[model samples]
Target: MAQLTSIHRFPVKSCRGESVGSAVVEPWGLAGDRRWMVVDDAGAGITAREVNRLVLVHPEITDGGLRITAPDLPALEVPTPDPARQVPVAIWSSTLTAAAAGAEADAWISKALGVAARLVHLDDPTRRPTSPAFSEPGDLVSFADGYPVLLTTEESLAALNDVVLASADTGRDPLPMTRFRPNVVVSGVEPWAEDDWRRIRIGDAVFRAVKGCARCVLTTIDPDSAVREKEPIRSLAKIRRWDGATWFGINLVPDTYDVTIRVGDEFEVLEAVAPGSGPLRPAP
Candidate 1:
């Protein structure tokens, strides 16, 4: 009887996310989720480590198109266009051809961050390859790390905060869920119940919880403005590290089909689809 209270999609990875009233669940990941990324001249990915200012960039899908605004510059606009010039880029293990959003986007990012960067679209069918672990013969993905959606529970965060508060020396501010950047934030569940949920139904959409999401420096960086803090990372390091990798959130495998998910949708836990067999530790 747990309900899905919120849904979010980060069109661009590691940047601010858009709180959607509804969205489509596709095999490649949430439709339009992580469909764009900021990269340097070599086509390597960029993150808060390379440029802290990247955290300052906030993006929202506007009626005109995708609008990117920062603290210092005017909003940069990217119109939804036919896939532009194809460019080569790598997202994790997948080497794919992404649509190049071109020089205007490049100039804006470069000027704002004082670094060479450009915007690339994750729409190329030929270059993008689906994860071998989950692809059906010839599936393709835009820019998701692996799965279609990343799920987290508010109860889990509350539990982690409780741990932080119980310890006297941490001196950390409890963070908003934004720091974790989850696609689905569920409430009313036992802390970490998602770790073992095999099939989860939210609204009309159903997702198969697959694996625990490995955490990275991105978790430590504030998504809104790319500010880095020690308490969260340090605290997570103390409690959530597993198998040499720090992790947060659960990665999900959607039943390869089009599922409509909207805001304010209700979720029903039909069964205990999967159960966590791994050790519970704080992400390091």
Candidate 2:
């Protein structure tokens, strides 16, 4: 059995996350995770994929609302928009309405990203259903990439780093799991063992593995320095590459609500596919 070693919560999308001891799992995701996001002047989503410096934006969930701080900027406290003034926002291919964070947050985030941007919150997360291909009818997600949560194991990271360190041209020392930005980090598993997991339980909540998370160049960016490198992505291509993309963590959708998943919780596989060939499978 694997153990849940860490639980990370990203209050605002594309920003630095906070490691928590425990959190309530809502149907869409962890209660304060990805509920807010930065958008362009046109209401399209903006992420660190384009502006690596966005990772330097640190957002923390406070009892009343959100407090955001950046490298040289003073901390700003933002209250949840009262009465939820709705505005149209586009995330990926999905179009939805969210609460606008007003001109204050917009101006602050705009300066942080060095672009014209606005901040918005998913006051009603139920408005966005997850992808039809990988999710059930009622499966919902926040401003996350797709699924409700992303799961990764330490064993897999260690194995991937081993191969990364062995590469002659690899410039990185070793990649940390933070680069993957997983919501739950599990320990005590063989490398790539999660490839066969179809369903899993972490404490009181059950989750169905929607799909293996296809990593992109965004993973190559350092969260601290915002520097972009090619080794992790380049090395990931060598071993985890298949299906025309490099694979990393597993995206999961929770089957239970109101369950608080804590650090050091028991993680068990409830179902699995037959061990076989796939992009997420272990290299032979």
Candidate 3:
């Protein structure tokens, strides 16, 4: 049986995440995951894609709200913003109202990134639904690109590393799972076994696999030095490239909320979606 080996969540979007022993599965996503984001003057989301240094800002979820710590910068604690102070923000094709985290947070984050930025929180995740093409009715997501959660398997990484070592032009250093920023890391699965999974259950919570997550340049950035390289993407381009984008982890939407998923939780493959078939029903 496959077991969850690790769990992580980003309290703020596009920044480094915090590893957690267990996390509550919410309707939108892991509770407190990507509920906050940094926005530009136009209120459009800004990510590490343009400001790689943002990864250096580590955020920890606190009882008061969020505390962010970064190199050469003082830690800043921010409380949740008032719902009435919402500002219009756009994330990809989806646009919604988000509450601004106030001028202090804006100043702190702006200085950290060396760009004009404002911190905003999704006061209501339900305001946006997962793409109808890939999700069921009422399936909601947080500030995550498209899905509530992302799942990756250890075997796939090993397999990719093997390919990387074999390729002459690609750097052979093994890539850490952090490159993908998966919420749940599983073990005991064959390489890329999740590509066909339609539904799975971990602990008491069930989840539906919606689609494969497409890779981006962010994966090429070294989380430690913030240096961008060409290995994983260069190697993945040769293996998983299609439609102009490389593919990696699978995106998942929870079937049940309020359940806590812990590391070491055994997972069951409830259903597998056949090629050309629609969503598969979970086994009874």
Total backbone collisions for each predicted model: 14, 0, 0
Q: Which 10 consecutive positions of candidate 1 have the poorest summed lDDT?
A: 275-284
Best-to-worst ranking by TM-score:
2, 3, 1
Weakest 10 consecutive residues, lDDT, candidate 2?
Answer: 275-284
In candidate 2 the C-alpha lDDT for residue 257 amounts to: 95
| Alpha-carbon RMSD, each predicted model | 3.6, 2.6, 2.6
Comparing 1 and 3 on TM-score, the stronger one: 3
In candidate 3, position 29 carries an lDDT of 95
lDDT of all predictions:
0.73, 0.89, 0.88
lDDT of 2 by residue, 191-249 (tens): 99888888899999999887899999889999989999886888889988888889998
Q: Please provide TM-scores, in order, for all candidate models, with all chains considered together.
A: 0.88, 0.96, 0.94
Q: Model 2, stretches more than 4 Å misplaced?
A: 168-172, 277-284
**Candidate 1 per-residue lDDT over residues 163-236, each given as its tens digit:** 66767474657778887878888888898776656667888877666567877777777765566765456666
Which pairs of residues collide in candidate 3? none
Give every collision pair in model 2.
none
Best by lDDT: 2
